[model samples]
Target chain A: MTATTDTTRDRIDDALVRLTPAQVTIAVLTIAALGFVLLFAQEPMVHDSLHTFRHAAGITCH
Target chain B: MTLTDHLVRGLKAGAVAGGAYGLFVALIGNPLIRYAETFEHSHSGGGPVVPRAVTALISTAGGVFLGILFGVVVIGALYYFLEPAIPGTDGTKSYLLGAAGFVTVSGAPWLAIPPQPPGVEQALGVETRILWYLLMATVGAFACGLSGYVYTRLRPRYGQAPAGLGAGLVFLSIPVVATIAPANPVSGSLPAELAFVIQAVTGLGQVGLWFVLASAHAWLLRRDRDEERTGYGRVDHRDPTEPLGVDP
Candidate 1:
């Protein structure tokens, strides 16, 4: 019974170990992908409009 | 696995994911956006200039989906194949790491411009056009993706540094710095300068983003190694160590 329990524990431990790398990779990839979309997708118009609006509002620039 | 091994894996994953995502955006997303724009134009009797907010929201969503697909398909495939080459790496972990890294660096900049500027009838010079910007972004993403693919090919074969490192260096130090240089003949007005600044800042940010992406790849590689030792079974282990194989 003790031997069987040890084997089961080892299996679980091994599974956990194997899972760590994949989990990390998935985590990184997901984060990076989401980050790219969020950062790059929405800024151009806002920046351009803000500039235009500011210019319209009598803001001068060098 | 060692840092070198992890780094190599990460670069490979980044390249694949980036490339796939870029391609999808160019081929699939762009067309979809165009179609949507056309549909909008046809329906409204002189539509209230499809707001930048609406266009941006749609494009960003498209980009996100593309990024996710890239992570799942391209990076996942590369990880499976390359994991074995680098001593202790596992396929599953590599995929995960690549996915995480991709999502993190995917949406660092949040801005959009419509293909046609609102209320601007006469076409501004082609260079400053919306189409041009989209093309540039597409090309940039493609280049980044190609770099990822090349990184994968080079790493195990030559045992070299991650391409992201070199990309990060060049992107940050050169073009970005050049944009900041006073008296850029390219940009005339302050608004133009501000636009240029936004580009420069984003370019520099890309370098940091790439570095983070590379780090994530490395982390995945390390995790793969641990998985191997722990005897974790993968969902699809057969092609896990084979390069560029189709996912089952």
Candidate 2:
């Protein structure tokens, strides 16, 4: 295997081993919260707003 | 810190930043664009204007959603990529990084690829324009990064402030290069005044958004540190100068 691939694998392995329970919980909860916001916040009230806001803010997101 | 903690922390920061950005867009940005649209409409027939209440509600929602996105993305990248490369840092150091990032992501890029409102005739197709914008943004960010790396390398010999000024000059030159590069069709329909205002805000507003987002994120990080607890009903505190995972 190439040196770069080995290094990346090593980094990922190190990261996986290093995570604590508390840390894992934090990440999971944060993801859940973010998903919730993305799904619910874009309802009729904010859905249209995103387009206007995107234009005003200067660039198209997608 | 463990990867999970880092992820969570970054997510929190991103959410805060994104929310602030969304709010600014909803309140100030939305209104500004709507007004600018008038100029656009004068050149091209306008559609019916949406009600103010509807706009407000939508923008507010957009604000919250974006706040979460920014908090997660920017903060996550900081922890994952930059933090590993540098020493561990705390909320105290976040401001400098945040400001630098702001300049890289939005400020510098916008100089070359200024935002255009509707009715502005453009020669380039959408895909091409977007590709150009992405390229310009990358160049802007690269300039900022290279400037910092050079400043640190030069600091001991030149003294800190002078080295920083030199770096600042170098950092700013990238955009000038972009500006002077081959010209695009440019905005055709809008009057000079309105077009300029829209362009100005598109760039400046990002700076403001990043500022608020960083402040909120720093506050959250500070609070996280304060609430830190160990298994034994004791508070775990560390010297502020040290990075988060480092021992005293």
Report, for all candidates in order, the number of backbone clashes: 64, 13
In candidate 2, stretches whose alpha carbon ends up further than 4 angstroms from where it belongs are: A1-49, A60-62, B41-60, B84-92, B226-248
Error of 2 at B158 (Å): 3.3
Q: After superposition, how far is residue B240 of candidate 1 from its true place, in Å?
A: 26
Q: Which lDDT tens digits does candidate 1 get at residues B14-38?
A: 5544454344444444443333334
Give the true-structure RMSD of model 1.
15.5
lDDT of 2 by residue, B1-248 (tens): 44456568767776666666766776678777777666664522334345666766665576666555655656554544454332125663566566766766666656665667655776666556656666776777677667767776778798878877877887767666677645657655678788777778777776766676677767866676566532344455766797777432
Error of 2 at B180 (Å): 6.1
Native-interface RMSD of candidate 2: 7.1
lDDT of 2: 0.61
DockQ metric for all predictions: 0.03, 0.22
Interface RMSD of each: 15.3, 7.1
User: lDDT tens string, model 1, A8-50?
Assistant: 2454444355467787688678766664443332345433323
Q: Sort candidate 1 into its docking category.
A: incorrect
